[model samples]
Target: MSVFTLTKEHLDVLEEKKLKSNLKLIEKIIRNDDFYSMDQKDMQYFLRVADVLYRYGKAIISDKEYDDKEIWYKENHPESHLYDVVQSDLRESGKTVKLPKKMLSTDKAYSKKEIEKWLDRILNTALNLNIDRDEIIIRVTPKLDGYAAYDDGSTLYTRGDGVNGQDITRAFKRGLKVTKSGKRGLGAGEIVINKKYFDKNLSEYFENSRNIQAAIIAEKNVDDKVKKAINDGACVFYPFSLIDNWTGHYKELLNDFDNIIEKIWNAVDYDVDGVILEAVDSQIKDNLGSTRKFHRWQIAFKRNDEAAEVEVVSVTPQTSRTGRVTPVAELVPTRISGATISRATVHHYKMVKSTGVGPGALLQVVRSGLVIPKIEKVIKPVEPQIPEYCPSCQSHLIWESDHLVCPNKSDCPAQTENTLVHFFKTLGNNDGFGPKNIEKLANLGVKHIHQVYDLKSHQFAMYGFGEKTSKNLYDQLQASQNIEIEDWRFLSAFGVSRLGGGNCEKLLQHYSLDNLFGASVEDIEKLDGFAKVSAEAIVEGLANIREEFFKVYNLGFNLSITPKLSEQQDSSSPIAGAIIVFTGTMLQGKRGDMEKHAKSLGAKVAKSVTGKTTYLVAGTKVGENKINGAKENGVKVLSEQEYLDLIAQ
Candidate 1:
């Protein structure tokens, strides 16, 4: 079996790479015992995959693995693109808009010596600006590990490719409040999940908080749990300006660096990967300037990964919701980095076979702060005991690529129970249908998701549930229906392959819930992100779930319909989808600012007017010939006030 399972979201990102090699080849490269001897092209492909996965929180190789490859690549090929530029986040395809301000990455420092050098640069810059070193203020704040975006009060934009980003204003519309009770338009910030809330409610369903963060900004319907978290103020847009910080002079910062870093790291409940130190003096920052990737005056301090060697007791196979069996190693209790470690995952059965990760095998494990500890290497080999049948159904297993699969998807008790559990869990408005409860019901002959929905209070009582528990379960079912949910989330709960929340929302944008089942593969492929293979899988999966989906969907739940792209394109706003050109600076804002605002409001902003121009907004210094030429082309000429008035309508 494959070591790591890639979601549709991951695949979508991979498809964009257009790599010459397939995923099978990439996995083989990752599993190779000797990375040093791999082909250069293969190594490059592996590096790209590792980079993307690391950013998405589905990192397959550890930091050391990535670093070793990177170091080797740099020494061998100094002119490679990887070394020349900063790798930006893999962005989703959408309307690209400019950020209000450039959000540059902070220069990172790993050691105290490096930090001291950075301080010298700051001091030099301070001298250049003719400011006393003692008067210079350095501010330290927790560097949040979350999705980065810019909030301009009315719109939220992803930090796409640094300068341009996709409009994610829907996050605010979904009731995501600002952290620290801060107001909007606080420039740059992160959309983060509360660590406490994630551990308690979402850890099991999602692999990491990064997954939850991505779901929040996804165009698809947000998960019910995430939606509730946003509403409860557990998830918020934490503007960097409002972050809890320690402000002190340069001397005070250097004197108590360790204590200050520790204090700021623990200051918030959000996931903080590091601490950021920046000069508060704007003049010093301007004098210091920036590189292509990072600002000169700001630096982030990151802790190193901690590793420990542990003996494996045995490897246990657990079947997941998708029928891929994961081999989890049971290790001798060993403490690593303050947390007691007893288990670590062996990526796939392929790894178990190749690496001999059997009973009594010794393994190297590393944990980076609160991140899940990963098995880095098998120190000692042992005969691997592979599973011959599905653990839950005793069905004969088969190999699908590197992963051992239980083909009994329909009848496997584990799959059915897990699917049922996922439905209610994703439907986050419900309660009492956890694993234990669902397992009990599954054992009592509840096979289908709608069957659980069909149960009454007395029926649950018949299955040996307590009277009070049965009533609560029934009430929760009612609440799941009565509480409003988005149609995209409703579709995703069906557990269809290639149709996660993101893909579901993408499809629903083009087709409504009622018409989605009937959408052909060709119809689906027409959407922006859907590739042919994914489209085929989605079409077939939808067909398989059509009956059951309609059964559950027709139960009269409160579902908000996803807005169609066509409907959005046909907006009633006067300037909606209109091509407009803004010339000369005026009183409202910068010309560039006006153009960005127009794009956010659904108007197409162009640099110059042509025959296709719908309106030409004239500012203070427009020449008479320019206005007359625009009028001659049948484009309406409007004063700045007239254009603003039209948009306000």
Candidate 2:
């Protein structure tokens, strides 16, 4: 039987002019429950049908299933137009009016590291303006998962494509009140139904809150029950300005981020999908302006709880380039989040032994963000399956800390293949050297990155590649050389221990890439953020890769050199050594040029405010909140003209 039934009327209403799918085929696909095996065209069709139906309150699948399918489609078809435009439920037949302001989607971050990187941008901006970083105040609010709209007192509009919206003013006319008795003209907010009211009065009738939300705004006559609910104030327009929030210094917010998020996540009665964080300083907001899709100043942190328990079919070991052996648990295919998960990593052999992650073991898996579903825990433990020998070389494995390691780093076919794959993946400027091609080439005696570069089109054809593919591969190799890539990225592609892109960039800022190999452990350790142990490892890794690196380096790839930190420190300009922040719209010059000018003057330009900032350079249209925030943190505010005058002095 079909999981859920959708009437012909429901399909007709949502179809409008969009592509229509055969209902029987859709039902068959659903009943088969083998979405992973389905063709890409069928998946796309199914997703479109599901999305339209869900939006129109006639869902054939659960929200989780819809989300999973959508995620799958996105991963497979990133360039599809489905991602560029907003997913609106509104039909094309409305009086389209320009909104009071653009309501762009909020940028998202899943981990604390991502948030920290965001904070670093704010700090950098503050440095540029000479604003004290500590003066930066951040505000956090619950991100409502409801129909987004704008309130302009006289008109309430739907958030269609952000800039233009349909006049849904009839929503207010139908007795939908503002939350907390809020006054009109609050600009942006969401129309949300109270969760308690939905559970008590509307749960049986509607599939989900989204269904009721769509019904409340439907052009067709509203149901009497929904009208009554709106009249009772169970459904209301909750403005972002009036939403419950937590405001504090950025550091304090970071220190108690989890606690604060939890406190505010449950502060509202409406459905919330995540927490929104933005700089309270208006200057910071203006300085870090909106991208085409979202504001750089604001971000939403979403948590996914799609998890499943599945039995492990077997545990297999794979060798990585670093000689570390990773344990992969092959499982009975189980759906988690929005994808069918057939395998998950066990972290290491230690986990396999300690958690008894073996055949017949029941494991709980949770998918978060875009990461592969992870084994949360072993639910029903069985005998641990630990490999005594490396899967690739059959070399005896040795224990290193909690990991199983293979000492055969040079000869192992798996390590060699993975290293080649890593190099092509990290170069990121070329394609056609994926795992399958790299593995085939490795089997044919092509083991090194430089060796791959030496191949001719005819040679590739000799390796069993087609003439077309061989020519394409040769062209891609040449393209990789011609494409300008950061010197740090080139170094990182070597996959040295403790020297990823970020660390490489940091090290290159102090010394040139050529000088990096000769640097000592103490030289690296003296830099900020690098510990002694990491310095030691990096020094050793660089030594190990030095010979191969020079061979690749001499092959003539375009590389951009990182500027030395000492060069900036030696400048004798008036603002020399001062940390400055620039905010708002600069009237005198382009912001990029201004930043370059600041750097030339020996001033450390920052993106956000911090305690060490010397001045907050305010430009035209700077917000009062930003000025006040800087003042509160003891940063002297300066107008653009005043900054120019001060530099002259």
Candidate 3:
């Protein structure tokens, strides 16, 4: 079989655009089936041409393949203007008109770390605005995979190029109903067909729903199958506001991120690419505005879990900074998503031993929304290859639970180098203290982080750095100390076992940095969220790093102190510690603003009323049944004005 093929329909569409030359290049790429060798110009052209073909319902490749190439192109060329504009739909004939509102593309996030970074910006902005941290609400909705459209009451327009769109009002005339009997004028939405309906009724006649969508709005007469699908109410336009969604505080959103994502991903029957996350507060959204390409307040999390089975070449044991020996499986070079995969880490030596992950064993590797691949399952077994000694220092290894540990922490070259690297990396302000330089310094008798910081320009030159490089390195160390960083981040740089930035921030909320080191295990265990075992580990870890921490702390680094929770308490407020649920259309201001205000007045804002809820503040349009339900649950019901009056007093 050929490596890839373009359908006759796809070729005809390309030929209509006078893209015969582009088609020759595309055909050559298909025959080659190698994206690595494609030049930048060729890659960009292929993407544009592929986009046009896909929009016209004559796709030349699967969505995953196209998305992979797009991601690869973006990573390689971030400055390209190709992604700045929305992908245009080139219908054969239509007089384009300006859309009622601009339809910008969503900014994409691939991992939880990126999402957290996005949320951090929101939190920081809220802090600057004096908004309560608990008041920020995040909304998650499924990102529909369908033809993009805009319905402004009367006209149904395509998202042609985000600014101007073609009027496809003939779609409504052809009996395309709003999804769930939802009314028009709901703004931005997508034209989608129900998955089950399409599979059961239209799949045999039409290749896919995209083809049917294209036919529904064809300048020519609509196809019989497409018309029937629309008439049967199986296909409709779904507005963004009418979709099923999950809403909660930022903490609950992050704490149950996986479950929320799963729940919203399958909430609708339409095809979903991912989930959309955005801050619901108008103040926060307005403060965090938009770029030309997309809104800063909104991000789409695309989960790409592509798996490929490949044979393992070998298993190698590498020691981490914490002296935990990790089993890394070297694999026969394979492509799982867009990136090449040569190695993946086994969870531990136990997995390697039990699963027999050795040379020539077949394993399934999945790129689960990550740059790095992970072993999903073992397909074929072979004799296990477990290491008895550390590869770097030749230290005797001991089994600690499921992991092998190298006990030579005081002198293990790998451990010392990795620890030094982690410290500088976590500091995130300096550039010259990477692994190569740290490893070079380690070889030259520099064993600790303090020793690296203590090196002078002449000492660095003596340690084998060039004259200019030595001066730059010394200056960077001084700069790293002077830049103001968060205390939690600084504490996290020490690489304690149970103290990441989140836990560090939590600990610092109750205790000052000066007093944290002196806290006992019992003291730490008393704090919320810290278990006894975690407290014990944290106490031991603090003791181990106490002396070195003070040495670095005394180095005169500028640090921003974390705010104390006690300082934010408003105990004098009437609703202090009261759980309040606000609902319906607010009159005095936005519902979000009211929630924020209530939180600032020391009330605990919740999305729904429960038995423990102190009050259900109802605004205009709230149902009587909902009010009675709260009252039946032993909750006080208050009108918007009544609640405001109480808070005022």
Candidate 4:
């Protein structure tokens, strides 16, 4: 398929000779480097350059290439700006037209995993807001691939840069009819022609619909074919709402991901790159809210459109400060995005061995939206190279799963340094514990977390740190402790195996900091979102950290306690602190009303029954599953009359 390309004049207009030269450099580098392979950096740069051209009405790649490959790139580098940028609009026409309404980019999901995560979030939000899960409805529609414009009866404005857009009323003036029989000013819409119409009628005259679209909105006279196409009723403005869609409750959707996608994908006459899925309730949408770029309640899933294959030049093992010999692929320098990348990480020697990620191996790499390109798939296999010794300490290595482990855990200088660095980084509210200072301190025998904290302002100057730096370090330490950090963050600073920030927060929310020291593996697993394996690891890890953990805990750090169910159990109300489960249908009120009443009484009404369930209330037509689940879990299953009677008493 024909794709857009850049001209010397366009490049010159942007004063982007460096980018042009870099593309040549990338091309030259690819010849030397293995094709089907690239470091994250090269893939990243290539994506930026390619996308920049795409935004300028001169895409250098096809939709397929851009989607698949670029999807790979974005998946790898989610933190990249391209992953975060509002891609639906590419700063249309450089004119920021005031929108009739704020047309926020929909929250996006690329895979079912993310979609499920979204579902969970919606469920959690319902629980928080005291709403019934069954009542939560979601709407899925085709995300039209065309110029985004908003209409307010009189004016049509491009969704230009989100806030301001260009006046594109000319398309309407040029006889663009509304889809369906809807009147003018139906909010957001896209300028589109029927795919069948484009192929049948306009294929001979225009290269692509996108090019033809540009011409239709131009200030100049429209082409005869375009005019004829317009007269033919093939081209029209399709409003987003008027687009066909699928709507259902969460469970139905959870069971049928493909059916939902395929139906929405084939819904519209316009070209669609992805599906737009969002919760339909205004309350949920408001609670979820939008970020600076997109709505949190909704998302448009767009796979990337760029990918390339390059060879893995070689796997070079380098020791981390932790003494783990990470395998880095030193590729022949290639350009991706705006940078020159000669190296990309291969993660570990295990990946090198299992996936045949080695010299002469062809690897498919893609730039993540705006993130560093990452190795996605190995297209060709090669002999693996496993390092037997730690690259830093030269200690004998051991196997940890697929990883060739550096067994020098305790005294390994790399591990010690990294551990110290992790400590300071996790503290979060401090400066001067960054790599440069920590490296200097570690070199001077400051290996432990307490040892670093014990240093005086004057002692830092003795370590050759400037006096100013030393005082700042002292102040940062003081400030870190003074800040009212959550108890979980304090524990997370230790970097326990299963105690990342999120887990720490989750655990703390269920139990007090002091109580956690006494928590068993079983106790931890009882909490929601925790599995037995992770709980076991956390229990063991916390045991190891208890000695050191208390030492730090005693340092007068400001820690806030996480409230608990037991503490709030007695409010003299009907449902406070009770683990209530609702079942069957109700007549006095909708199931929604009963759930809300329980929440108002401060009760934890869970979706599923468990051993800890305080009361399971049955209404009418209560299923055997509800009864069996409550009985199996050892919960008190009560009839609607019995539950009401108990609550009254």
Candidate 5:
């Protein structure tokens, strides 16, 4: 019934190997979110279309997205990848040039559980091969979200479907630089551009960096801007070995994931979607081997983020509390995962212009975790669309660089409406006052969290909600007040910039919610994790929210006091202060979580349970010879619960 379906017509097109049209229709479906919403047949349609498109240059989504969707479909249907790589499509990829050394796709893991599974495989490997787990090293690198390519001294080739590619040596002649002194060739790498630089200089001219990359490889002439960027060295061919990384044994990696990822994500100025984790063991590599698609020993740990590509059917302006006019993109209805998506937002008008996001433009919507995915890339360009006035408040909108703000913040209905909604969403204690309910409340002159909380039974019907819904909303307000909540969670509910769940927890760990109002920028920044800029904004933001914060804090709802730094220091014990490393596979407990728990007690826990390791906690799969070696070196070997009991003491 929709514009595209996976009918015999689509299959015939697929069978015929019609790439351009296949991509066009697939893009249309993905852009509309229709591909994900279809029946089994239609799901097959868009997925196949996406697969074919990825093999070509014009990907409907990303390689990460394609692989993820393929895996997802395979999990549900199990018959998916069967239709996966048709032999005919393989030939289109070109003759199988045995990769300089077969470059296999990284095995993927969606969660920590899957990571444990990987570790389990490694343990099995050590047991079978008579290897020492302590000697095994694990390495993690940021997976560059860019075009995959391989260079062999003379030729720069696309990682064409993972093996065999057309020689794109001209990309180098076009002046593409090697990232961080990456020389002519050391094997496989990626082509990427600095995100911040692209945002500033080239976005106005190019829709997305992918386009520029495509141009660099196209048989046609290059864009002057692309040439300039290459000349300026903003874009480059980055070898994986040249990039920044985090390396340690498996136990240490599991113990310090958040810290490690934060470091790796900021390691490069380019776009990075996930971290690539691989074992640095030749024996493990040979023993574990690989499949037709991926290597069993190496895995890419990617977050399951939601993303969509939608049309800017229209840009409707709405005023914010700060009088900022945020542009809302009303997309043509589509579905992602299982949800029908029709609306999304842009950061500001400045983002609108520099990013080339306008009416009829195709934009990539990658949701930030569970939150909405902002426009990360503008795929197709159209004439720029500028809103003359705020759609809701009917006030003239003026620009502040990338953002258009309304001067009517004092009385804009949209601002007042969204503000009210933010308060309820932030509290997260009671749920009845969601968007629909709060919108009703705002229309009836209920503007603030306090006002909504103070509502009477009759106030619900006054706002036009049904009697039942009204009473429930009122009860929800009371229930929110009654629920025990944290000081930081309560603070984050207000959605102050730079102050979310993590920062809120960090701030509360240092200062009480009561004292935060008076905390200076210097005072806030003194705490760990609070950078100078965020501290300044948070201090200023807290001052602005003081009246409301006090109003709610005075409500006397149950609140959990975050343990202060002083208290944590006092509770820290010296016995808990040893840096521990786990060696050999533990038969009794999980190596990953055990290290984390050890670190919690002020002990610096480690991977590769070693000679210097304070405690070599042995488990079932641990080798006796390895444990004896550790013991001979004076490392204490604690049994599973014995280590637990030690920590308990």
Candidate 6:
């Protein structure tokens, strides 16, 4: 009945700490679940206790509860010392050593408004540096919920207090492999166990993956099951560089924020609390440095999960490119989490029929992940409004599992128009093919993507576009072909099932774009990460789009090839397998161009100077402090000309 019963283990872990004096107050606050009434000292102590328990993996409260209290504390006491320094989670007795590189936490934004403000700051900084707004790139990756560690090849260190950490290299000694068999020296990453593996093999014995993670690094004999998990590669060290990522222009990121966040959030098998967004431009990152806790160039978007109750006005059916008729509930406009919500989606027609989601229905709506509005619960039952025909085409809809799907995929205007729009949007380099324009083209008999590309300026005018509009459309089409994009992206634009950008890149890493058409289902299934069902689906989808794919592929569109991984490993380039950091302004050419050139030579380019870096290439206006820091880290400092000469040799 007491809250302390649940947190007794955490207290045992913290027996030697000074927080025990406040145990009665902690218990009282935990029971009441109140943060506003607490004095500043009690509030700060409670936060510290929560944080320490969380770091030790015996968390006394859920992350959301902890965050709510932390936010309250910050609002009431803006100048608290808790914001001044990074906290250490490592409690082992080993002496701490300087980290090979700093491992800062990410600043968090709970809503779109906060994210937009961060974007504005990035824009202003880019403008001051004379960088084009379109040129500013953003990189997003899953924020893994696991033990944070840094691998400098020779030793692995915990992220203790940011600057110094205890050596936890014994984890590797216990046969913990890197994720995807990646080579060592990838710098910062986390030690995580695969979710599926834990559920299947260790769930009955371990309370959670964190318990197994703690056992892996404990200064004692490893548990047999934990050792087995490590040997099986189910538990591994995942470097940030090797993790799945989404990179694009900031415009594309904002335009497709929800989809991007969701995709990246589910990209990995490990548990993730949120998605991390960072400016990818080295100059931007250098300009926006770090605070004591987190970097200014990066932020984590966490879910606020605020909920509201509202009455549904009506249910609307919309058709997607996949021919699924989705049920959308329109509600009386209500605000939650600082944003107005007018509509939310029901899972399917099955949910509508089962839950009676119709006009006058009272329902609970929540901002799922503080991003998408979703119908959480049906509060009052009413006769459900179910559509018998597709909303776009008047074709009969049939139940397929839980979904009501439109069978007339070929003639459905919504499907065709959405497919066309998806192609251009996935291409990410063009702006002329929006929904309205695509619908106009579809009305004029533009069904396939190749047909749209085939439209001449005169043809656009024939299609009833204005003279200037026609000219611009044709120019955009030409521009799409002239502008170079990645081959994986080009393949993904076809919109084949199971052939997303990530899958395409993985496939391309092994097979050439031309060779993919010849690949069989068995061949694809044999590759890592592809199952037989997915391989079959991909083969069937490719067959359905084969003719159209060739037509589009042969359009003379410029595409940069993804280098084969095997060839990259065998590369004889002068700087192959070296981690190099470029600093200061370059006179030979643009810094971005130089970094790209280095990557092409099979070298890893890092944004900051670190101990694992093989070379720090200094250019004009180089800072003495930076060069000296590199030297202290034992990195070889090379002048721009000398580096060029060495690579030339």
Q: Give the TM-score of candidate 1.
A: 0.47
Ten consecutive residues with minimal summed lDDT in candidate 2?
83-92
Per-residue CA lDDT of candidate 5, range 1-649, in tens? 1233344433544665753344455645543443322334445666666665444434435554555556645654443353444322442334444345445567777677888899889878988999987877888899987777888888888766554566778899888878877688878888888898889998898756765666676667888887888888988999988878888988898888778877886788887878888888899987776655677788888764566777878876665454466666787776655545676666567777777777799987664311233455789877778788777677666554345655443245656665566667667667787777766667677776677767887877877778888788778778888877766668877756567666887788777887778889889888888777667667655665577767767877787676665655433564466867665566557675565455446666554443456887776677665676566456788877677677766
Q: TM-score for every candidate vs. truth? A: 0.47, 0.52, 0.49, 0.50, 0.44, 0.48
Candidate that would win on TM-score: 2
| lDDT tens digits by residue: candidate 3, 1-649 | 1233567887887777656566677865544333433445567778877777777766665554566678756764443566532254444456888788878888888678889999999999899888999899999999998889999999999987776789998999999999989999999999999999999988898877888877888889988878888999988999999999999999998898889989999999998889999999998877776655578889998765778998999887777666677777788888665556777767678888999999999998766322345576899999998888877789767665577766554356767766687789889999999878987998888988788888899999998899999999999999999987878879888866677666897899898878899999899999999998778767766776687788888898898776687766568898989999999998999886787577667777776666678999999999775786586567899999999899989
lDDT of each: 0.77, 0.77, 0.79, 0.70, 0.67, 0.79
TM-score of candidate 3 versus the correct structure, residues matched by position: 0.49
Candidate 1: worst 10 consecutive residues by lDDT? 30-39
Model 2, 380-420: lDDT tens per residue? 99999889988888977766557776654334665666667
Across 446-519, the per-residue lDDT of candidate 6 in tens digits comes to: 89888999889999999899999999999999999998888888988776666777689789989987779889
Q: Model 4 — which ten-residue stretch has the worst lDDT?
A: 28-37
- By lDDT, the better pick of 2 and 3 is 3
Ten residues in a row with the worst lDDT in model 3? 30-39
Candidate 3 residue pairs in clash (backbone atoms < 3 Å) = none
